[model samples]
Target: MKQARLHFYAELKDFIAPNGQNKTIVHNFKHRTSIKDVIESYNVPHPEIDLIIVNNVSVDFNYIVQNSDDIHVHPANASIKQINIAPLRHLSPQVSGEPRFVVDVNLGRLARYLRLLGFDSLYCNNFDDKTIAEISSITQRIVLTRDRKLLHRKIINHGYFVRVETPKIQVREVLARFNMYSFFKPLTRCTFCNGKLKQTEKQNIAQRLKPLTKKHYEKFLVCSDCNHIYWQGSHSIRVARLIREFSKTDSPLS
Candidate 1:
């Protein structure tokens, strides 16, 4: 069996097995192999990779693997000064102005969290990768997902790999990555429907409100798209607490 030497740098190492991490990894290969396939075989998604080097020379994903090759895989956000070589498909610049997203089904909770934070997040439980890819390209929404393969779609211009599994931590991961915490507008959007929340008179939506809600809450934000009403009720207290906790948690800026 022919063999190649490999190493993954920075957060890219998170995708591989423990044995393959933090050091040179030896991979045995048969027949011809592309660098992309070889890297994905180790479970690292191609879109998350910034650069690949073989035998100390920069190469692209389609570069065919050769026996006795020395490979280096760097994270998508690696500093050019660090590697002195650009990674293929550089993680696109975070779009200026408001950030929008087309999220995959597996990240439903993260989608809602992003919506609550006032980002325009569009997520459907049945969204296929092709639809997500098209929507991302046309609407310029960032593709947020745990699925590495979705980000690998060639049509995608801006996308992110949500590294954390927990919803709260995932929210933090996104905020820190895009520097979006400064823009959070709590309850400004409908968390369920992803529609702009509008201010409404208590009497207007009173028919839909519970007696307790009508009696207790004065101000409300109604969803223009879904007509869902939001108020600073008990849930708001919990939401506020969660926001405070996230703000206080030490997040590593990506």
Candidate 2:
């Protein structure tokens, strides 16, 4: 029987056995298996892997395991580059343009911040775990969650485990992780309903707003589905400032 050594780096290590901390696993096999399959067999998804190295050369998911080979796997958000493994599969490509996100119920604040940044972030406090998993799988939307177990779901292809606890930190963490500082599109989506906002004459929504709002704010946007009104209130400026602060941070994953 031939044996190989495997080492998972960064968040990839989260799936390894408790005793496997920063350590390599030795597995004996009679036939070769693709690196992707081996990794997924251990519960890590293909979408979360950014780099792989085998025997000191960059490799991809398709690389076949060989006897005595040393395999290293890195997560998409790790702050490292360059590994010694043959390139068998290229780095996984990120979703182009503004990446759409689906946040678990626990991440309501993060969802709001993502919306403030003009990303299509879908959030529902009432969604069950199964529903979230199904949405993530069917839409190919990136799943953002504080629950590590959610990201571990078998059906989820795109997912991220949020490490930050504070809402502000979480916003920065996501921005840095997705390299989305330059993609900010403010006020494009309804923060309340996750619906696209449409430009409307202030007079159209006069009755819906407070008496002061109707008289003071000229620019207005209304949700097509929920009819929620949005304006450049003091609250909007604060949210925008928070986004600007995050935009200055270096994206750890990019």
Per-candidate clashes, comma-separated: 2, 10
Q: Can you write out model 2's per-residue Cα lDDT over 116-190, one digit (the tens) per residue?
A: 778888999998888999998999899988775676576787888776688878888778778887887877888
lDDT of each: 0.82, 0.78
Residue 27 local lDDT, model 1: 91
Q: Please, what are the lDDT tens digits per residue for candidate 1 over residues 42-68?
A: 777766776787876788778999999
Candidate closest to the true structure, highest lDDT: 1
Error of 2 at 50 (Å): 3.3
What is the Cα root-mean-square deviation between model 1 and the actual structure? Answer: 3.4
Alpha-carbon RMSD of each model: 3.4, 4.3
RMSD of 2: 4.3
Error of 2 at 13 (Å): 4.0
